[model samples]
Target: MAIEINRITQVNKAALRLPNQPFKRFGTLLVTRTETGWHHQEQLSDQTFEQTFPEENYQLSAIDAAGFALGAFEGSRCVALATFEYDFHFNRYLYLADLKVDPPFRRQGIAANLLNAAEPLAKAHHKRGLCTIAQGSNLGANRFYLAAGFHIGGLNTNDYRFTSQEGDTDIYYYRDF
Candidate 1:
């Protein structure tokens, strides 16, 4: 497929039936959270996560609110996307709420390309930075965000548990432009 990353223009019926984006799940993110600090470990395995962006059922509303959305396309099909907005509460940072690419297209820089597309949009909106959250179970995503220059912003242990092999903590990451 000839991949093209472009701005989403129309959200018609055709756009609603996007292809499913799934990723192979490998390992689990082991986290130990205490009153004083946190510890993490990754135990590799062979598993998979299939996502059709079920949340995207509400994507039109998100598209309604977003500063913009970028679609990574294989021809006319949207195989990947990054959705975000400039909420005043983020101060100078744009809040990146969703970023996903189909498993078939992983490790090809599709998400990063979408993010690269987002930064200029954020800057054009007069924003200074960007921020996002990664679930503790998604160690690959955490590594991606870190390598992309994002750092831990904060954590909410109460939202998730520490004992389970799949952690429930929200790991916030921020990157300044």
Candidate 2:
């Protein structure tokens, strides 16, 4: 089915989920830190790791926060979702909070379209740039952000301490307009 991208409505917000298909491809992200510095790498794998979307009001809060919640719709069903909020911390940078595409729609360019669509929305809000945070263990996500020309803005190795998810790290990236 052809994909259509647009901002999601409040009613559709509850449908926010990790794709409908099984996540069958990923690479293990290797993270290490020492006094010398930090090292991160990805070990390619054919493993299919299923993904689960944790429930949160954050996506809906995007609209409430002077931002938008973009969705990639395949007809009436949403195939992907991307939401961002404006920030004054960096002269109105668009801080992306979520970007998820259903597994069945993988490799279909829906993600790219959604991201491209977000740029104009950010610009419309007079935002200076785009920024986002991702888990260090998510190698694919890290690669996508890096390949999109975003530079590492910050890193907090203990960012996930409260969640107590072991060595999970928070990686922040940003692109200047």
Candidate 3:
């Protein structure tokens, strides 16, 4: 069946609580800066490891108030989701706080489709662009963001400092409209 992309309505907002699908990566993307410009290179780790972000409980009201939320469905089942919110922290950009596709539905362009659906909604809100952050160790996500026309705009080297995730970097990506 074809995956349907639809705006998340209040009645079906619960779809945002998708099942956690952990990921494993064999290496991490290392960021460096030279006189020329920022650089990103992948370094293979000694061992493969799985990482899973803590589960998030998104309030229905908050989801409603967000700039937009979309779900990719195969019939009645929601297999993927994307949510964006207006961020004026630095500029008028929509922050893609959440984007996920279940394991069985991945690699079929569902995630990309959701991103395509989000761009117009963001443009409709008069936002300048869309932005998001991915863990440096998540090679697949970093690659996807780059392939989707986003550039590595910045990095937070201290975002995970003093935590279990210390040594992990937060890579920020932005796609200008």
Candidate 4:
């Protein structure tokens, strides 16, 4: 059976009710965020960032406050997530962070869909581009970001200080819309 891309509408409307066949055929998925559901948002936050960074830190909180939280759900189950944070230093830009696809849903183009959804949002906010940081040791993430059209901007030594650990290396990547 051919998967019809047109059947997947970006915006949901009551008149265009998705058929159960298509829902079953494509596995009925939707992308949404925490402001839509407080419980979902809390679960998404706990699952997305708890293992990687200081979950209770002020910086992360600021990021969460300013950022747009996104998640892909199959029915009510959250299968993937990505967050975008727009920041201004030398210029205005957006940072893509905490991109994660559930282990069972990997290689299904979900990440691409999430990114596809983000580009316009960034553009609407007048962002010059999108950026991301990948740990040097995480080769899979490094390759994934690169494959998604993000190019290496630079490498920083002792850039990130997490807890008591010091001198962590992080590679930055950016893509102009």
lDDT of each: 0.72, 0.73, 0.85, 0.55
lDDT of 2 by residue, 95-154 (tens): 887787877677777776887888988898888788888777677788888877777766
* Deviation in Å, model 2, residue 9 alpha carbon: 3.2
Question: Model 3 reaches what TM-score against the true structure?
Answer: 0.93
Candidate 2 residue pairs in backbone clash = 19-102, 24-48
User: How many clashes in each candidate?
Assistant: 3, 2, 0, 0
Please list all clashing residue pairs in model 1, or write none if there are none: 25-47, 25-48, 27-45
Off by over 4 Å in 2: 10-40, 43-51, 57-62
**Candidate 3 accuracy as lDDT:** 0.85
- For model 1 the TM-score comes to 0.76
In terms of lDDT, which candidate is strongest?
Answer: 3
Question: How high is each candidate's TM-score?
Answer: 0.76, 0.76, 0.93, 0.61
Tens-digit per-residue lDDT, 1-177, candidate 3: 989999888767878888668877878888887888779998887998876777888776787676678999998789999888876366878899899889889889998899888888888878888899999988889988988899888889999999987999999998888
> Residue by residue across 3-81, what tens digits does model 1's lDDT show?
8878776653345345556544555555565777655677775666643335456455567476666788887787887
Model 1 misplaced regions, further than 4 Å: 11-20, 25-53, 59-61, 161-167
lDDT of 4 by residue, 73-168 (tens): 676455666667776345566888667666667778887777777777788888878888876544556657777887766666576676343644
User: How much is the lDDT of residue 112 in candidate 4?
Assistant: 74
Q: On a 0 to 100 scale, what is the lDDT of residue 75 in model 4?
A: 62
Model 3 pairs in collision? none
